[model samples]
Target: MKLPKELVNGSIIFIGITAYFLLMVILGYGNSFYLRLVNIFFVFYGVNRTIQMNVKEGQTDFVSNAVSTMVTSLIGVFLSIIGLVIYSYMQGGDDYVQSLSETFLFGGNPSIFIYSVSLLFEGIASSVIVTMLLMLYWNNRLTAD
Candidate 1:
């Protein structure tokens, strides 16, 4: 039952995402499941990377994991936002945000730049949060390994 480092991380990410996706669905956030899944992948990857940190031999490198996760999450969130915005614009600018599902799609204002920035911030924050949780798990397992 031994798993390589990469497999372990990947498995963790896959399981985590599945759990989150199911939760979102159960909680009624699954209307745009496709979009949410795409966005969540980035967070999953980033969090998985964070969980890769190993300090088993009196070693510590939590900061590196934190940074990587932050960066990855940011990228994921940004990509998701971009997809949403493009979809929104295509559906018809002012007329698009009418639906409840579309309302949750996130198009802050008329400016693309502002929307981009907002998504970027969401990415960064999400990545940081996901990574932080992974880091805690990693740290705890470090000594047990």
Candidate 2:
């Protein structure tokens, strides 16, 4: 059975994010907030690829394309969060989260769960925004047959 283009693109996003984060840690810049923001490009690339594939395949319904783009981004976000949670626990659980909260937007010494949940919410919001923006760009470019 063939995998959906969204799934494949989403996995690519997740891989890119994982590699980028690991590279940051290796380069001693893991705590840099500005570097962290670069991860959004991975989501944008993956989501855009899904929409492009849909258009190439002649599936030009705006709603369906939007849904596909959202799903692609959400997959990357969910997987990345799960990886973050697991890595946090491996690196000292709440202590790791506390260190992260220092440089990140989170305040007040949150626990691992709280940090992960907060990130999940942030990821969801970004996913929605990326989806909308990409849909708007694609809508202007795609014409129904």
Candidate 3:
């Protein structure tokens, strides 16, 4: 039974982000520079895998690659957000929420308004940046005359 291409790519993104987050949690690296580095690495890894999957499926056009990367990145970001929420709730949601607000926002309280807006913008920007960077890499590597 062959999985759909989108499903495969989405799984890659979700798994990559989840793995990174889990590692961070296990290592107690939350809100650290190492966590940021790992996040960047996992995001690019997902984009790379998505591009590779596109090539494997013979959908290697620039648009296809870019779209796959963007879709996969978005899915990963969505899953990561969900995972974070779940983790926070599991680890006493109130304190987790306060920590996030203090860490990211102005250190007051967990304002759902600010958190949601920030995540939305950050996810969109991250998808665009990752897609562009991966497309550039693939174009230069795969389409050179």
Each candidate: how many clashes? 0, 0, 0
**Candidate 1 lDDT over residue span 1-145, tens digit each:** 8654444554454455556655776888766736564646645664565444443333366676566555555544555555556655876754544442344556344355455566567666666677777778776766566
Candidate 2, residues 1-145: lDDT per residue as tens digits?
Answer: 9998888998999999999999999999999999999999999999999988898898899899988999999999989988998899999999989999999998899998889889999999999999999898888776532
Flag clash pairs in model 2: none
Clashing pairs in 1: none
TM-score of 3: 0.81
How does each model score on lDDT? 0.56, 0.92, 0.73
Model 1's TM-score against the true structure: 0.53
Which residue pairs in model 3 clash with each other? Answer: none
Which one wins by lDDT: 2 or 3?
2
Best by TM-score: 2
